[model samples]
Target chain A: MKQDSESIQKMMIILSKGTLENVYAAFVLANGARMEGINADVFFTFFGLEAIHKKKLEHLHVATVGNPAMHIPTMIGGLPGMEALATSMMKKEMEKIDMPDILEFLEILTASGVKLWACKLAMDMFHYKKEDLYEGVEDIITVGDFYNKSQGPGTHILFI
Target chain B: MERTIAGNTISLNEEGYMTNFSQWTEEVGKELATEAEINMTPRHWEVIKYLQKEHQDQVALSIRRIGKSGVVDIKEFYQLFPLAPLKTATKIAGIPKPASCI
Candidate 1:
């Protein structure tokens, strides 16, 4: 399709990290894009699929393993209670800015017309059923389908 | 910088968005539209009016919100403003650049 001269009509964001910061960035950018009148979609894969999973989403943690900010050795990330501590701290900071929790943010994005998709391969590997995901997920599509749907004039594909 | 419209000095930011919206007039709108290379039409005026009102209300303006306001649908908004609808329309309407714009 031929695009209009200057408007960005479509945006595709691929979420590969379930970390709080990454998920937050994806939603912020998607919301901003939709606010600009662009059609936006987010495809969740691998660890990212956990973001849309109902049970997992509620307990999202900041990835401490291999995270340079953590400073401590990566092995410390495997210790118990670290994830819970990080999750709480992140949530507290986000609340200061009036940003909703991850689950609420996802619902707001969906209500605002941002398409959500789960990767089929990830679902199969993780054994995630459609019912296990949040209500707004459109479908379990392969990466190829994502590429095909994202193809068009002024389409922006971003991987995060 | 400023543009004199109808004997009124309308102050504008360095980026050309109006700093004082109260100084905006139809003549000023026409001049701004021309600078953006858009020929003024009633439909364009509709959007410009709506944008000005939203700015006064301190509402965050977006294409979807504009469409929901019944001023115009997203497709028609793009058609009216051509490239960069929100940016161009807001500029023509004498409002600040939308936060969503780069």
Candidate 2:
């Protein structure tokens, strides 16, 4: 039946930015898929590796510079503490909406059975070892391995 | 819309969630669970009861809230209902579909 092909069975989200907004967007999408009875996987690469890095995950900041949505002048947005101010405000709003912190969200994703993968190339480029990644990460895999694991008729890949 | 469930005609929403909670019975829940392809255990009943209580008190339902509800954790909740636990469980509980995404 065409129904099988029309329905979304899996989501493969690739996160390539270290910004807090991007990381949360990827996490929420992956978690939302699982909540809807669909399988999901997140592949962290490039600057996104920071999201799974044990020591850096908690300190991610919203990108205020060059973000027109921030509504502040670019020069002002680039000032010291601007990103922190924006990040803190965003965090407060997220909490108001019952969104979990990055660490807790990772735990929830793991508990919800969303597989998390770290890119080998990015890990090596950043000199991050497996132990340096979040404990929930399933493995450090190459791009080819990620594509291989994510294959399916109804599977969709998204880059963020 | 009205549909027959467990031999009882029930009022339901467009998404098939029950519109009247009073019409719900354990038997209806059983049949709904069967339709959702879940075999009910005592554990499943417990979560349904918790959801019913929350709905009665007008508490919003979300995966995050359910995980923090102390009745069941997220992992076991997924295992219990297996697919779309919140929506399926709420449907069986005869409550309105939750608008929560988390």
* Best model per lDDT: 2
lDDT by residue (tens digit), candidate 1, A1-160: 1248576889999999888889888888887776566889999999889889999997778877788786757787768887788778878987765577788778667756789999999999999999999998999999999999999878889999
Q: Superposing all C-alpha atoms, what RMSD in Å does each candidate have to the true structure? A: 5.6, 1.5
**TM-score to true structure, per model:** 0.68, 0.97
TM-score of chain B of each: 0.89, 0.96
Highest DockQ model number: 2
Q: Let me know the TM-score candidate 2 reaches against the reference structure.
A: 0.97
After aligning candidate 2 to the native by TM-score, how far in Å is the CA of A102 from where it should be? 0.3
Best by TM-score: 2
Q: Give model 1's clash tally.
A: 0
For candidate 2, write residues B1-102 as lDDT tens digits.
998877888999888799999999999999989988899999999999999999999998989899899999999999998888888999999999898878
